[model samples]
Target: MSETSELLSGLALGAFRLNGQFLQIAEGLARPAGITPAWWQVLGAVLREPLPVAGIARVMGMTRQGVQRIADLLVERGLAEYRPNPAHRRAKLLQPTAAGREAIAKIAPGHQELADRLVGELGLDQARQCLEALHRLSAALDHFTDHP
Candidate 1:
């Protein structure tokens, strides 16, 4: 294999492993709050303010249907509520409820602790560099997509 191919393969494998670890942590943290990792993500997205489904999907890098499914689940669970959108007749805006906010607030401290642990293990400077590299990679990949 060429050097570029070998490097790409290693990067792919590392990304997979890191994603697995992240999901595992998210799952564990979400379970006690009576939510799945996906639901938690939806709640986090709405924590700032109401957003259209498409907007949320774009932010989360997920399909609209996938985000809609999670939004429906959140609404059904009474964790989030949908408001009518003035600009878009069909698209409703999503916002977290008190319960949803509370759930995220509860998890924030633990999440911060986990972040601190990771930073410590990796060294703060190294972790910052890693984040910068990932951001650059994300931007490069995003350029391929039509979405902004």
Candidate 2:
């Protein structure tokens, strides 16, 4: 195999491993507040603005059905509520409730602690560079998928 192909394979493997590790950490950080990692993810997406399920899925790079399921659960639990969307008649926007914000706030300390530990281990500059590289890779992949 070419060197580029080998590097790509290694990058893919590392990303897959990192995804699972991050999910595990997220679960640990969120479960104490009675939300799953998926719930936390959806809530995080809408922290700034309410989004329809499709919008949330797109923003989070998740399947629409998966996000919809979680959104429904959040509404059922009173952590989120649906409101009429001015843009789309059929699709309602999911807005995080005060309770949802409080739950996420409760997890902030744990999240910040983990972030600090990772930065300490990796060194801030290295960690930032890694994040920038990963973001660029994601953008490239997204472009390819869009054009393909």
Candidate 3:
């Protein structure tokens, strides 16, 4: 194989494995908060402000339909609510309820602990470099995908 092909394969495999590892850690951290990893992910996307289901899906790297289903479930469970969107009538914005925020609050300590542990293992400089590299890689992929 060409060197570039081999490098791309290695990067892909590493990313897949890292994704699984992060999901496992998220599951563990979210379980005690009475939410699943997927739920936590959706909620985390809108923590700062309300968003339409499609926006949440984009932020969470999920499909709009999948985010819609989760948003409906969250509403049913009293964890979130739908508000009329100013931009679009049919597409309502989703925001976490007080209960939802509280649940996420419950996960913070564990999340921090895990973050600290990982940072310690990686060292602060290395962790920052790793994050920067990932960001650059993602941006490059986005650029290529959009252009191609």
Candidate 4:
């Protein structure tokens, strides 16, 4: 294999490894609030404002059906609610309820502490550069997939 192909393979492996570690961290951060990381992710997506099911799915990098299932659960558990959407009658908007906000608040301090520690280790500029590179890489992959 070419050097570029070998490097790309390494990048793919790194992404898979990072994804697992990230999910594990999310799981721990969310547990104290009595929510799974997936639930926390769904709620976090809607915390800023109400969004339709499809919108939430797009923003949260989740499947529409998966988000719908979680949204239903959130409503059933009193963490979220579906309000009638003026734009689309059938597609109601999902928003975080007071309980949802409270749950997220419970996790915020720990999340911030972790972030602070990471910043101490990595430095703010280095972290921002890494984030920018990741975004660029994601966009490049997206472009290639779309074109292909």
Candidate 5:
């Protein structure tokens, strides 16, 4: 195989493995808080401000249908609620309820501990570099996909 082809394969494989690892860790952290990883993810997306399901899907790199299903479930479970959107009449914004914030708060200690451990293992400088490299790779892939 060509060198570039080999590098691309390696990067893809490594990312896939890392994604699985993070999901597993998220499951562990979120389980104790009475929420699944998917719930935690959707809730996290709206912690700063409410957003429509389509907006959350775009920000999360998830399918709109998938996010919509999760959002509906969150509302039913009393973790979140839909509020009127000033910009769009039909597409209401999703915001976390007080219960949702409490659940997320429950995961914070475990999240911080895991983060500290990972940073210690990788070293702060290397961790920052790894994050920057991943951001660059994601941006390049997004650009390529957009242009293509």
Candidate 6:
């Protein structure tokens, strides 16, 4: 195989491995809260501030419909609330409920501990460089549209 082909293959495999690891860790962390990893991600995004469904969808790189479904579920579960959006009358702002904050707070320490372990294994400086490279790669890939 050519060098470029090998590089692409490696990138694909690395992405799969990293995604699997992330899902595993997230599942473990979210199980106690009776939420899925995806739910945790949505809740975590709104934990800091309220955002409209479209805004959350953009931040998460998800379709607005998908985020709306998750938001509805969160609201039904008492983990989130939908408030009127002054900026857009048709859109509602999503905010985490007290329960949502508590759920995230409970899971955060374990998540941090796992991250600390990984950082320690990689050495902090090396981990930082690796993350920086990944961020650049993500930016480059973000230009591609899935259906266009």
Q: Please tell me which predicted candidate would have the highest TM-score against the true structure.
A: 5
- Model 6, 1-148: lDDT tens per residue? 9999999899989999998999998999999878888899898888888999989988887898999999999999999999999899989899999999888888988889999999989999999999999888888777775434
lDDT of 5 by residue, 5-79 (tens): 999999999999999999999999999999999999999999999999999998888899999999999999999
Candidate 2: the clashing residue pairs are none
lDDT values for all models: 0.89, 0.95, 0.93, 0.92, 0.96, 0.90
Q: Write the per-residue lDDT of candidate 3 for residues 1-148, one digit (tens) a residue.
A: 9999999999999999999999999999999999999899898988999999999987766899999999999999999999999999999999999999999999999999999999999999999999999999988887876588
Least well predicted 10-residue stretch by lDDT in candidate 1: 139-148
Candidates in order, TM-scores: namely 0.92, 0.95, 0.95, 0.93, 0.96, 0.90
lDDT, model 5, position 84: 100
Query: The CA-based lDDT of model 5 is what?
Result: 0.96
Cα-based lDDT at residue 72, candidate 5: 96
Which residue segments of model 4 deviate by more than 4 Å?
Answer: 145-148
* lDDT at 115, model 4: 97
C-alpha lDDT (0 to 100) for residue 43 of candidate 2? 95
Q: How do the residues 19-100 of candidate 4 rate in per-residue lDDT, one tens digit apiece?
A: 8998999999999999999899999998888999899887776899999999999999999999999999999999999999
Residue-pair clashes, model 2? 0
What is the full ranking by lDDT, best candidate first?
Answer: 5, 2, 3, 4, 6, 1
Q: Could you tell me the C-alpha RMSD of candidate 6 in Å?
A: 1.9
Model 2 lDDT tens row, 1-148: 9999999999999999999999999999999999999999999999999999999988899999999999999999999999999999999999999999999999999999999999999998999999999899999899877688
Candidate 1 residue-wise lDDT, 43-104, digit = tens: 88878789999999999888999999999989998999999999998999999999988887
Instruction: Sort all candidates by TM-score, best to worst.
Output: 5, 2, 3, 4, 1, 6
In model 5, what is the error at residue 42, expressed in angstroms? 0.5
